[model samples]
Target: MTHEEKRAWIRLIVAVIAYTAYVVVILRRAEGGPLPDVPYAAALLWTIGGAIAAAILAEIGMAIVNPRASRVIDVRDKEIGRFGDYTGQAFVAIGAVAAMLMAVAEWDRFWIANVIYLFFVLSAILGDVTKIILYRRSVPTW
Candidate 1:
């Protein structure tokens, strides 16, 4: 694969891993148990550490694979990114509408939150997949 393609795959893998970790953490928190009190300072430190680690790993991975090109995101990439953002927003809107309707109908369920989260994830995945498909099918520019 080209360096750019390899970098993209690496990024996708990292994103999947990070998101899976986040989901697992949330699930663990949801399980009924005596939760330890998290101090704000400790929580802030943890958040910062996680963010820094993730950012460093991502940057290093991309730099190692595609040092020059990794620093630049072209117009096509920006367009695809915008498309993804739009898809995410659409998912959020759909989830909000569903929640509102359910509330109006007096349906209360804890699983609704999970459904909304899944909707967002699925929407993002679909958007990325669609963008890749389009990129592959389109004619190349000179």
Candidate 2:
């Protein structure tokens, strides 16, 4: 696999891990388990802080392991990123509209939020997969 492909995989893995952690947290909260008796505000703050820290550390580690591989993305890379972003955004917009309609039709529920989140995650995965397929099929610009 190319360096870019490796990087994409790393990002995907990181996203999956983060989302899995989020799911676990939500499940725990729903189960009414004691979570150190921290205030909701404090928990939210800590989760955000931890996510940021984890992202920073992952980036640093990826760069350290692939210094030359990670530096300066080329034009094709930028194009792929743009395409993926646009695709993901389109999915999010569609998901939001569907969620709104569902809320009106069926009443708001936790499952609606979970469905939206799942849509977002699936969009991201599909976008990355599409980019990789394109890259593999097309000739390299460089």
Candidate 3:
């Protein structure tokens, strides 16, 4: 696999792990209380911070292990990157719309924050997945 492809895989894995960690922590604290009462802001912040750190560490480790293998960035890579970015941006819009609807409905801040966070994670996952698939298969001409 190419270096970029490996990076995509790393992102996918990190996104999943980070999201799962956030959910697990929230659920553990949730107990039997109402959903809005669950402590989520700290968990959300931690997961975001941790995910960023993990991603950077993973990239550094990958670079250190095989310095020569990770240097290439070519035409195909750029194209795939753009495609993946465009694909992922859709989710951000969706998330914004969801948050707007929640606000209109007078939903709790917890729900609104969680929904936004979830959409960001989904965007990362979807973008990474798109890049991975594009790397594996030929990008179709449109």
Candidate 4:
């Protein structure tokens, strides 16, 4: 696989693992209690930070293991990246709008924050999946 494809795989794996871990922790904390009152901010922040760190470390490991892999970017990489970014950004916009509406409605901060975080994680997964798919299928020319 290409370097970019490997990076996408790494990100996808890390995101899934981290998000799952966060959800599990939150659910356990919510046993017989309201989810909104489960003290999720720390878990959310820690999971996000851990995911970022894990992805970076995994990429570095990949580079170390395959020292000869080309790091050079070409036109295809740019096109695929643009396509994936656009696909991912749709969820971000949706998340922002949802959060804004929640705020305007005076919704619970917990709900609003969780919604935003969920959307962001979905965006990453979708974007990484798109990039991996494009890499496997070959990018189409416009």
Model 3 bad stretches (over 4 Å): none
Question: Which is the leading candidate under TM-score?
Answer: 4
RMSD of each: 6.1, 5.2, 0.9, 0.8
Query: What would the per-residue lDDT of candidate 4 be over residues 1-142, giving only the tens digit for each residue?
Result: 8788899899999989999999999999999799988999999999999999999999999999999999998998888888988898889999999999999999999999999999999999899999999998988777
- Ranking of candidates on lDDT, top first: 4, 3, 2, 1
- List per-prediction Cα lDDT, in the order shown: 0.55, 0.66, 0.92, 0.93
In terms of TM-score, which candidate is stronger, 3 or 4? 4
**Would you list the rank order by TM-score, best first?**
4, 3, 2, 1
Residue range 7-81, candidate 3, lDDT tens digits: 899899999999999988888898977878987888899899999999989989999999888567999999999
lDDT of 2 by residue, 20-44 (tens): 7766776676578544332344444
Query: Which should have the higher TM-score, number 1 or number 2?
Result: 2
For candidate 4, the per-residue lDDT at 83 reads 93
Candidate 1: stretches off by over 4 Å: 1-56, 139-142
User: Which segments of model 2 are wrong by more than 4 Å?
Assistant: 1-4, 24-53, 139-142
Give the total clashing residue pairs for model 2.
Answer: 0
lDDT of 1 by residue, 80-132 (tens): 55664565577778877887777677664444544555565555555555455
Q: Indicate the worst ten consecutive residues by lDDT in candidate 3.
A: 32-41
